[model samples]
Target: MTSPHDDPPRRPPVISSPRRAAVSAAAVTAVLVLACAALASAGGPADRRDPTADPAPEAVATSAPLDVAADRLTDQTGLAVTIDALSPAALEPGNRLRLSGQVTNVGRGSWRDAQVYLDIAYDPVTTKGALDDANSSDEPFGTRIVEFGLFDRIGAVPPGTTTSYRLDVPYAELPLSGAAGVHRVGVTVLVTNRDGERVEAARADTVMPLVAASDPTPPPAEVVIVVPVTAPIARHQSGNFLDERIAGAISAGGRLRNLVDLIEAVPPDTLEIVVDPALLDAVQDMSDGYAVTTRQEEADQGSGRNGTGQVEAEEWLADFQTVTARQNLLLMAWGSPDASALASQRMPGVVAAAVRASDEFAVDSGLITPTVSWQKNGASTRRGLVVSRIAGAVIQFVAADNLVNLRAQGESAYLPSLVTVPTEEGELTGVVTARELAGQRLTMSTSVLDFRQNLMAEATIRSLEAASAPSPMVVALPFGWNPGDAAEVDVATAFDLATVEPVDLKAVTQSTPAAYPGPIRLTPAQSPLSDELTDAIVRLRTNGNTFTSLLTDNADAAAFDRRLAVSATSLWLGQPQERLALIRMESRAAAEQLRKVTVTGPTFVALSSRSGRFPLTITNGLQESVTLRVDVRAQNPALRIDPIAELVLEPGQSRDIEVTTRSDSSGLTPVRVRLSTVDGKVFGAPWEFDVRATQIGVAIWVVMGAGSVILVGTVAFRLVRRIRTEGLHPREEPNP
Candidate 1:
């Protein structure tokens, strides 16, 4: 038997010679003859058997007992071990590695005399691929450190109970005598089974990157850490917050607060923060004492309770401004909308509007205008790139894995940070972020130490793999990323390692872009916005434009556009129903505003002559001045009405419009009156009234009188003629 400290066995050497080849042939021939003789003695009807027949039952049963026994041994214990804390994340010569965590009896059975030991793989992981596999793998690596007084022992662990454990072992006791690099470190629990066999009950593994003093250190690699300072969308279109979550988020020990604290801890030039203008705008409003509508009904009714985050908002904003003043900042489009979904749905107008609004906000608030566009959730498409180009973005940030061509090149260990993406509008610089490192920032299952060590290991491996000439790499945090308070320090430490040199994002973008393969490849969006939601957004924007035309002031129109942009944010992706509901709410609010300007008139009117004038009341109920035109028409052909000219109304002002009407005949005629904006969009429902012409015209009277006079004269003439011809009485007596 070999000792665990000994190196793994090596393969034997092969010999190639004519004499050995002849001896091997003779041995093979003799073995074949012996096998044929043995088979003939034990077989029955071998010629009739099919070549594809299954093995015999006895042959299959040979391994079944071993599998059953192994399974039975595994089910004997119910222990679960976890590593909560590790001291000295990096191991050095003569230094001790200490770890502490809890072990719980999750299974039904209890474990007696359970012992916890540290398992270290003496063989260091040399390649980046092997390191990644070790980080994600579950199987234990290396031999257990079974030395006395180097492990923790628990007498008994009953069901549904938990126990604490701590293991401390000196570096010398560990069988680690190889090149310094990342190694697989794990904790295993050994329990006795019913068969008196000590089997592994449970195990937990993590990465341990060893940096010894004797090992040669390489030059640091350039890395760009892009941190996102954003929040989920929660504001209503009417400038009221939908909830008070932002208050907690910016308060002490909150997620946003932790980010600010983290930035303060690190060097100002080492980090790049991507800020969402909408988030800052909301916080500014909160600092000014805003209102929050807790329920949808309350929002629809225009009622809300006063928020209580003025102090927190003020503090956070002040700190944010102070830190960002000395640091590099990149502004995202307003609300950080889902540009990919918009492009896929064929809505570039929304993207353009969002970009414009973000620029305006940045200028007004004394912040940097955004020149780079980032895809939400690190997803991108060809059309998405075009939209970004049209939105005035010079650079586009996308996940590395999304580029199929780059992945197919099989150079993931060290890919250039920048690539040129061709679009219809123009070419854009595409910034590729490390997919694995970016994803690791969002994992919460591992301990902070594990997370920090894994990050260091990944960076170290990259540096080692590209030792010849290391290219710049970008590690962009996921959208809405919130690293907890405890992990903030750990994350900072990970970047401060000797193997990594944090650089500003601008440095990476300024470098020459690598040439990408032809025929760009992009992965389909996993959670794209539905077609119905995008169509509704388009309709909502169209209606918003029409509604804004009623206002004479351009500022109010711009404010409404910002609200529309907020509603189309990426926060709504994969949430079609919720987004549709928000669109409906916004539509109703706009309709309510349009209803403020209306036309009211009398239902019935009397006209003393063929031509007359009546009063139609026009009111502007909005808080701002409006310029509109009044249109009136007669429903009957016998009636004619003159059009009213454009008029301006002040806030809460009412005016009576005099409408002129004329009729050819003396009768009642129906007239309809409507109000429209200067842009020719109808404001509200039409008002109808009946106009009765009471008096006839002088021409009609003259014609009637002349006709009567002629009739009388004719009658008189007829009577005189009848008398001359014969007596009128005689002619009447002959009628039968």
Candidate 2:
């Protein structure tokens, strides 16, 4: 019946009111949550739990000894004594040992001016071999050994003082071959209080094993262990005060001095002297046959005053010399080789050849006082080891140059307060820093006092040498001066002359020249400013125009230099049209090229071209506010030029300037504006701008518009539907 054209006007589709719509949404949401919960329940716990990786392995532990101590000691005289046990002992090859035993003078009367002698032995064998061809039989084992002798004179021990002596002995001297499997090694302690006197009661013993090796490898290298000639931190101090002073004077600041100072500076418990790799090599070479290849001596011949001048001296000389010693011999053989066979055949032949070479070099070099000794303290379980140790006497060479001007000599009253010496810069006085010393050539730098006194000694000396027969050059005393201070001197002129002529004093009356005051001891503050000084100074004002310019150029440098620069130019056009135009044109031209300028205080940089940078520096000269116009124009592409950013700076304030560029044609434009403090000396730091692409903002706007449209449409549709539903349901339905 409804299929007919219009069967009982169909009732309008039922539309829900606001409350009904909300109820329907809640019902749908509840159903979806329940479905999700049912699905989650189906999964297993393992699937929901977090995943974990594998575990790591554990660590293992090992043990090692902590300390090695010398536990025991023994005294043996005459007979070769052996120490069987040393307390807390750990003795191994390559590890050195320090031993101390007291020697008392039991005699009633003090041993006046007596001396004690002790010999340090290494290995078991004593007399090894002969290093000299002239001497067939060498000194016996104990005789050839190194001896440390102690002198007892001043502050002699009273009858009951019982002077106790301690000596340091190395482990290398102990017999080691028999103790290879065992941990202990036998030691012999010998003492002779009075040289050649009756030997003390002998004690021979062995020490407990202190060290053991896990591996059989030999030590990497042989070491030369040096014990302080005295107690720890106290080098040579154990001796008399006078002796200590003498040692300090002779060795101050030298290698020996530095080594002693370093040891004293370190903790006392540390006994070994650990040398750096490079220094170790030098020590080893010296311990071996590398004798001190160079030698010289200072001899003071004579001195006298030259008239009114300071004390003058005569010529000095240095003689060339060398000491003859046995050449270092190296013996090598397989570890498995038969000792007797090798010693008889190869060793003898090798020894003969070495002796021949040693004698030849000695005679050829004119080493008149040649003496020789042989040493063999090392062996190898490896294929073999080479024997290398010095076997020669130290030759004394004569050094007689510059004796009159020596620093030590100057310390005495025999020298005058003001001494004249030829220097590279001329005749100067005072102390000097030694730069080079060889033969007749010696170079030195001026000291604090000497620099002021003879600053131009070098040039003055050269000029005087060029003048006919060195004349009495006038020396000007500068602000500060001191005797023994040194200035560089050029002696090339005297090099050609075999000997220097002694100065002849001109006779003068007592009143002719003022009585010469003796040498003045300078205080910490006041310097003598001796008249014998030669001031070295190049007056820039007096130099040639070209030379002056070259020497004084901002970039040109010598030993020292200082500079100050001030520049001002206007790149921005204003009132001074002509001047402004000129500067602008120049700046524009410079802008075309890559321009980089660093400035202090306010600065400005501008550019309007591609492939170019323009650095601008503007100097302010006006007393009040100053303003200038900066023109920016579009050059290539869709160009963009920024406005002139101002820096509000106090008159004295300085800051860096920045400039940036951009093109709106297509794609993203990246431009940088850099602002930084000059060398970070002032306040502010350098920074750059991070600009985002223009398209990103457009995307945000599109998203906001879509969201607004959807919100309005939803509200309108809901309202219209609610109205229709309300119209249909005149009365409210019963609450469910």
Error of 1 at 420 (Å): 1.8
How much is the lDDT of residue 456 in candidate 2? 21
**Candidate 2 — which residues are off by over 4 angstroms?**
1-69, 74-687, 690-736
So what's the TM-score on candidate 2?
0.18
On a 0 to 100 scale, what is the lDDT of residue 78 in model 2?
15
RMSD of 1: 15.9
Candidate 1 lDDT by residue in tens digits, 1-736: 1234423222112211110000011122223333344455677223344657743211100101111112222234545566666666667677789887666664557677677778777777756656755665445467677766776776578765667888988888877755767776767777766686666886765666665542577566687877778776676677777767788778876768767866776665777788877788889989999988744655557677898889999999999988887678888777767777788777787777777877888789776546567766556766776787688765678777677777422445556788877666666678887656512333212233444666677666666665533457787765544444554234566666777677887788787687664344455544666677777787777667667888777576667656776667775464567668777677777788888889999999888877888889999999999888888887777887877889999999999878888777767778888877788877688999888877666898999999999999999999899898887665456568
**Model 2 over residues 114-184: C-alpha lDDT tens digits?**
22222222222111011111011111122111233221112233232333333333555443443212121
